[model samples]
Target: MHGPEIVTTLLEMADDGQTRPTPSDAWHLFLSGLRQRFRLPSGRPLAVIAAVLIASIVGGFGAAAGSWAAERTFADLPSQARVEALTRQASPGDDYSYDRSTSAWGTDTTMGALTVSDWDPASARDRFAADGWQVTTVRDMSAGALAYTNDPATGSMTPLPVRGSQFDAVRDGVFLRVTGYVSPGHGTVSVMLWPDDTAAMLPLMLAGAVLGLVAGWMLAAAGAYRMRPLPAGRRRVATVLTGLAVTALALPAFAFYVNMTRVLGPSGSFVNTVHSALNASPYWSYSTPRMLLLLTVTGAVLAGAAWATMGRRGRSTPAADQIPTTG
Candidate 1:
């Protein structure tokens, strides 16, 4: 074909959208534009991009695992009747308090302790048995191990593998322990509970996995961009400051995302209730404030350092040595 005819055909194809770029093509074009705009080296940018992608994928799976565990833990909790029964079995003047701590994802433990006078271990065991509750006695009292199931029909007392200094008794959804001090003439009876059901977390896990992947990818990309090399001047200072700002903002963003992905309705309602209960506890209330304070201080320090470093660099570099803009 003649040159003019060939050109006219290409123009027609373009106008008709026959040659429009695919999503993949557009993504490549966008990356190219970014590389040119930031003067990023080809190899390093690719490596950084890959790292961000990997981080997002890993983060997504982590979120999924966490959500699943949380749901399962929430489902395994004992019935209110069982808790009430145990509490009522305590001595007449027993003082009760709740103690809880979360050590890992999907693992929440609450220990209810009752302090009683004239305590008797055998009496407590008998009390539980009288109430139709399964009672487990540890033969090696020194070792202090206990495991029992509350299932009325099939539950039985069993010996737990004795571990280190920690005194623990866990069975089904409740763990019980009675510790006495010879001098004080008083004993503390503690009931530890972990309620979990495997099926309860499916929907929330699915949603959190999806949303976490998207958010992780976005946050990763922003992080990589912030770390990109810049010509030493106001631009570098600005990038660093922006990064610090983004880092500071991430805490709230994470909290908001968690709230959005929370389980709802009858199916996973227990999980939501458990989360609410935990959040109201002192540990959560204090930890959140401390975390925010740490982030704020860290961000401010980093921003200040970036500003100082950039100002010093700017003063040392001659105007003539500054990078020239490309057309």
Candidate 2:
């Protein structure tokens, strides 16, 4: 109980493996350490954190913008305005020429003189319903019935790594061509030039950003986040960046799941064409199932990371016990 004895005891505890700090003490130490390491006021670290988050999150969005803009260069996206202009310029004697600007990513294809006896987006929905085909992509046709599974209602995005036909168009009651992606798990049934009105892109973007940050942070944190040889500021950066990276990664995927109204859709045009083609050939098959595996794995990772984020307050915990270190 003497002052010198108390000093000896405290020094022992500081260096002792078994000694543990109380939660409150740990919190104070953690904050003081963080401030000293980051070389900023307590408030400044939060601002710095927000900046990285914005970079990773908003930068991820740049992926889509970049995708759309770059894709537009090679493949012109079909514009409603362009279609309208063509519809007007053509006379009864002249068949209207239309185009399906599926993705600015690629493919700038125009339609067959695809004369439109009538063009209506509203009536098209009715025609789709009558055919037992739901309106996945909600674009009105100039003169045919076409719909995709991924709704183009919510956002302007194409399903990740688009699997099957990217668009659908039906001409003259018999001619149908639906184009989309056919990736490993899910395939696409692109009814319009874009992806789901569903929010897949946002999450995917975050996943990419988080992945980048996690990777970058790992390199930094391996040396930075520790109790020894204090890399101090870099350590704090690693920690904050890590948290920001994780949030960036998980938020987007969460948005997709919470809005589970949409699925990776297939094209009704493809379905009808297959039916018609089967009537003639009697045998053919091209099927793609749920990207659920990717979704599942992604969900597991994001869920685990999110869980870790919630639990990881004011201290570092070894993660190997909670989840896999590598994907």
TM-score leader:
1
Per-residue lDDT of 28-112 in model 1, one digit per residue for the tens? 7579655444342346665355435434443444454446555555434455556545545644436677656553123455556
* TM-score, model 2 to reference: 0.26
Model 1, position 194, has a per-residue lDDT of 56
User: Per-candidate RMSD vs. true structure?
Assistant: 13.9, 20.2
Q: What lDDT, from 0 to 1, does candidate 2 have?
A: 0.35
Q: For candidate 2, lDDT tens digit of each residue in 151-253?
A: 4687554433322222233322222233323333433222333221222333443454455444433333222223133346644554554555555444443
- How many residue pairs clash per model? 10, 23
> Where does model 1 exceed 4 Å of error?
1-41, 45-65, 72-85, 88-117, 129-135, 139-185, 194-238, 245-289, 292-327
